[model samples]
Structure formats: structure tokens, C-alpha cells
Target: MSLFPIFLKLTGRPCVVIGAGRLAESKIESLRAAEAAITVIAPRAIDAIAERADAGELILRARPYVEGDLAGAFLVVAATDDPAVNRAVFAEATASGVLCNAVDDPPFCDFYFPSVVRRGDLQLAISTAGNSPALAQQLRKELNEQLPLDLGDWLADLGNLRREVVTAEPLNESRRLLLHQLAQRHVCAYDQCPSRLLAREHARTNPIPMEKA
Candidate 1:
């Protein structure tokens, strides 16, 4: 299947999880990291989930999920061990037009959770289209080992420099090319960086028209 990858902003958005076992707990934690407003419905929960509930991190309804449990939810995770319960939740979410993931049951899922490698604000996600999660996880491990821990910090500095350059430079092909060149060079946000100094000199010498700059 062809999947369209995306990054979602889940802050303050309502999300539901239909179980509270270990698998479900992982999903809940990921949602929590995104600052989603979470509600978990299960007849029983593991200690960690219960503690989070008591701590007011999320709403816990210690009962079997009933109809309307997914009301107003942006997404639902059917993480129950029982296939019937997971299917039921998926059906309800489908009818309500909410995204659903029936854990480990790829055919019933509207989305699959990917194995991710994170470094500060940088995230690399890998998926095998539900074909092989193990392979995706292997790839994630390889990438984590290869990527530098400080890459995200450097990216942040590059982003800030780009913003400043865009504001000061002219709107032309030369300026556009310079931005790409700057990205290729090992340059920091400092004014003394060789690439930045060269760019500044170039801008001074080849000034664009006032209306275009």
C-alpha cells in the first residue's frame, strides 16, 4: 500500500486508547509526549497506567469500551488483546471518521505506528507498510548509531542563520543558490564562519535593486 507520511501536531487534541496493557501503555506514552488529551478505556489497567491516571495525566475509564467512547476523538488506538474488542473499536472509529490503529492487526488499522529515531527536534521515522516492523526497527537502530547527537543543534543554528539571510539578501537566483551552498558548507551561526563571511561579502558586492531585495 502507498502511504502518505506526515507529522501531526496533537497538542490538546483528544485521543482514545481502548486498552491499558503494555502495548497500549506504549501508545499512550507516545501520545502523551505529543501533549494529546488522552482517555483510556479498559476493564483493568497495569500499575503504570493507573498511576498516570491518579496523577491526572489522563482520563481513565475502568470499564469495557462502549459505543460513543470515541466521540470527538482525533484518533483511537485499539490495543486490546481481544480481537473482537479491537475490531469493534476500529469499526466505531471508522464510522466516526476518526483514524484508528488496531495494534498488530495491520488489516484493521488506518495507520501504523513507525519505529522512530529522535535527536532533540530531529526525528527519523521508518515503516515497512506493516509488512515487517522488525526490519523498520533494525533500520532505526542503524540510523541512531550513525547520526550525530549534536546534528539537531547544528540544524537549529542553520535554521536561524537561514532566516536572517533571507531577510537581508535579495530575492533572486543568486541568493537562492547561496542558501543551498550555505547548507552544504560546515558553517555555524557565528559571523566569523568562513561561509557566512564569504556570503556577506558577495551580498555587499552584488547588491540587488531595492524593490527586489
Candidate 2:
């Protein structure tokens, strides 16, 4: 599948999950991490899902899903054990023009959840186009081990450096070279980056000369 991968901002957006089993719990947790306004529908939920409901993390409709459960939902996840129920959800979501993912069923899915390696804001997602989830997970594990832990902080620093250059430097090539040079110090082992300060100083001192157009 030639999927166009994207990271969606689901904060405060409505999301519906059509199951409350262990698999659904995993999907729900990922949604929670993205701060989506989640509504779960199932006749019964597992302990972890029940706990989340009790803690007010999500809204739980403790009953079998009805036809309109996905109404006005931005995204839907059908993680129920029953294939029939999952297919029904996929159909309804498709008809309503909502993005849907039927867990473990690639043909029924509009999207597939990738195995993710996260270090704070730095997240690396690995997907095998739903062809091999196990392979994706293995790749995530390998990347997790190889990638440095302080990468997120490094990225934040680099971002600040980039903004500084963009504000101070008028020449596009000068800004590009500075950004590329900063990218070379990736795979950060330490959180403290003295280069960020130096970069700011460089931006201030070496102002891009104006072109005599």
C-alpha cells in the first residue's frame, strides 16, 4: 500500500471506539495520548477501560453499539473481536465519510496504527503497510535501541536555532547551511546543548549581507 503517512492533531476532536476488549484498550490508550475526546461503546469493558471511565479519562457507553454511535466522529476504531461487528463499523464509517481502522484487517482499514518508538516529543513510527505487524514492531525495537534518548531535547534546541536563523538571516542559503550543520549533531547523548547558544550568537553576529539588486 502506498499510504501517505500523517500525524493528525486530535486534541479536543471527537473519536469513537467500537469495542472495549484488550485490543480496543490499546487503541484507546493511543487516542488518549493524542488528547482526543473519546467515546467507547461496548456491552462490557475490561478492567483498564473501566478504570479510565471511572477516572473520567473518556466517556463510556456501557452497552452494545448501535448504528449511530459513530455520528459526528472525526475518527473511528473498530477493535471488537467479532469480525461481523468490525465490518459493520467499517461500512458505516465509510458511508459517513469518517476515517476508520479495523484492527488486524487491512482491507477494512482506512489507516493502520504503526509500532512507535517515542522519546518525549521525538516519535519514530514504523509501518509495513499492514503486511507484517510483527516486522514493524521489530523495526521499532531496533530503532528504539539505536536512537539516542536525548533526541527530543536536541530537536527542540535545533528548532529554536532554526527560528533564530529564519528571523535574523535574510539569505536563504546561509539559513539552509546553518540548519544542515545543526542536523549533523543529531543522536544526542546529552540534554544540554551549548551549540544552541552559539547558534543564536552566530545569527546575531553574522547577519546575512544584503544583496545589491
Candidate 3:
């Protein structure tokens, strides 16, 4: 089946995780990395999860899963080893219209967590539609090795230039093409760089009319 890939903005969103073992701990950490407001439900939690709760990084409920646990959650993760409990969580999540991922149980999951490689603001995610997470992880490792560590920093510079160009230029095909060319050829916005010089020349020669500005 084809998947519609997306990057969610989970900052300040409410997310629920069921179970607190080693597996649950990983899911919780991934949610936390996205700055989601997380609540973990489990009768027993691993040391890492307990410590995080102690530090007020997340809300922890020292209890087993219960009905209504997923209410109002934007997303839910069922990370328990118990297949019954995972299915139960998935049912409630489906009824409530919340996205749910039952780790390792694709049939009960609304989504699967992709293996990710992150560098600053850049993220590369690999997914195999829950068929083979190991393969996704292997691909992530390979891409991580091939990509330059400084690529994110260079993208940041390109972003700044794009913003400036948008503000200073008008809507036109030349402007659009110039932006694409800049991305392909520019490293950073160093004034001495050939690409940067070309950008400066374009802006200077094709200034927006006074009325348009």
C-alpha cells in the first residue's frame, strides 16, 4: 500500500503512550524530541522513563491502561508487549479519531514510526510500511554516512537568502528560476562566492519598480 508521507508539527500537542518498558521509553523519547506534551501510562516504568518523569519532562500515570485513556489525545502509542492491550488501545484510538501506532503490530496501527536521521533542522525519514523496520534502519544509517554533516548549516544560509529574495523581488518566472539556481549552486551566502555574486548581480540588475516596492 502507498503511504502519504508528512512531517507533523507536534509542538505543544497532546500525545499518549501506553506502557513504560524499554520499548515505550524509545517512543516517549521520540515524542519528546518533537516537543509534544506526553503522558505515559504504565503500572511499572523503566528507570529512564521514571527519571524523565521526575524531572517533569512528562506526565506519568502509575497504572495500567484504562478506557477513555486516549480521549483528546492527538496521537497514541501502544508499546506494551501484550497484544490484547495493544489492540484495545488501537480500538479506542480509532473510535476517538486519534492516530495510533501499536509498535510492531501493523494491522492494529494507524501509522508506523519511521527510522529517522536528523541533523539540525534537516530530517531524513525511512519507512517500509511496517514491513521491515530493520531495512529502514539500515537505509537510514547508509544515508547518514553519505550526507555531509554541515548540510543543514548550508541549507540555513540558503533559507535566509530565499527570504530576502522573496521580500525584495516581485513574482515572476525569473525570480522563481533564480531561487532554484541558487539552491543548486550556492553553499553559504559568502559575498565572494560565485553563486552569491550571481544572486547579488541578479537583484541589482532587476530591482523591483518603485511602485511595486
Candidate 4:
């Protein structure tokens, strides 16, 4: 069966990471970037992870995994070195109906963390279905170089214009086509103001006709 692709809303949501090694640290960083409230469980934390905990970046619980640790969590990550512990966490997550990721174990994971590239509010995720994470990381690096830093800002501007157009105009096939074309054209442009204005003018000029009663 194919794994389903999902984008979760983690802002202000509780996320539990059951490990404190390098892999767990990476997961914590990613979750922090998404503004998730993170709680990490580990008997021994590495220097970097300890520093983050000391700096008040994440909440660290210096204890072993317990049964109710997965309770009230929106998401969980199992990155321990022990395969048995990881499997146990996965089972608990499944029983609780919480999304879980067992690092480097595709069979045990409900979701796999993808190598990601972030530019402001824009994010690109690349996954290999656990077949080759190295390849995914390499592709993400290549994409990082290809994507301009200003693209995120441009995308945000286009999004705002799209919302305005959708609200101001009637929903019709012609309007939808025009909007799609405008979005595609402006997304690739460096300067968005002119393109946005042109789109608005085009929409104004081609108003949807009302049928006679």
C-alpha cells in the first residue's frame, strides 16, 4: 500500500519525541521550526540537544519512555537506538490514533520525515518512501540552490492577490482558468506588482455575464 502524503498543522500542538540522540535532535529542530510545543523523553541527551534544552528552546524530560507518555500528544517520534523501544512507541501511537514516525524504520512508522528546504514561509519536502534517504537529502540540497530566497515573498503576494480576486469576482469556469493562468505566470516572475495589477485588470475586463430571467 502507498503511504499517504499529509501536511499537519503543528502550531501550538503537542509533539513528543522519544529520544535524545542526533536523530531525535533533528526531529526536535524540525518541529520547533513549525512552532510545535515539543516534549522530549531521553535518559541521556547529547551535548547539542542538552544545550537546546538549557536554552529553553525545548522541554526535555530526562526519563525513559512510559506508557502514558503518548497521551494528549498530536504527534510522536521514535528515534531511540533500540529497535524494541521504537516498536513499542509505534504500537502505543497506533493504539492512541496519534501519528507516529519511527526513525529509519519504514515498516514501524505511520509517517516518514522528509528532507526539507525552507525559504521564509515556503517549504519543499522530498521523500523516498524510506528507500533512500540519502538521495532525498541530496535532492533537497539541489533544490535549496535552485530556489531563490525571494520566491517565498513572491508567493505570499500572489496568494493575497488570489484571495482578493476570488472574493471580488463570481466563481465561473472562465474566471477559474484566468486565475490559474495568472497564478502560474506571476509565481515565476521576480516583480509581482505589475502582474497582479494586470490580472485584476483582466478580471475586470472579462466579467462573467448573468443569464436573463
The C-alpha lDDT values of all candidates are 0.90, 0.86, 0.90, 0.85
Instruction: Tell me the deviation in Å of residue 90 in model 4.
Output: 1.7
Look at candidate 4 and tell me the lDDT of residue 93: 97
lDDT of 2 by residue, 7-87 (tens): 999999999999999999999989999999999999989999999999999999998877888889999999888999999
Worst 10 residues of 3 by lDDT: 186-195
Q: Is candidate 1 or candidate 2 better by lDDT?
A: 1
TM-score of each: 0.87, 0.88, 0.92, 0.84
Ranking by lDDT: 3, 1, 2, 4
Which is superior by TM-score, 2 or 4?
A: 2
> Any residue pairs clashing in model 2, and if so which?
none
**Candidate 4 — worst ten consecutive residues by lDDT sum?**
185-194
Ranking by TM-score: 3, 2, 1, 4
Error of 3 at 147 (Å): 0.4
- Across 1-213, the per-residue lDDT of candidate 1 in tens digits comes to 999899899999999999999999999988998899999999999999999999999999999999899999999999998999999999999999999999999989999999999876789989899888999999999999999888888778777777767777777888888889878867676779887787777678668668876
CA RMSD per model (angstroms): 2.3, 3.3, 1.7, 3.4
Better of 1 and 3 by TM-score: 3
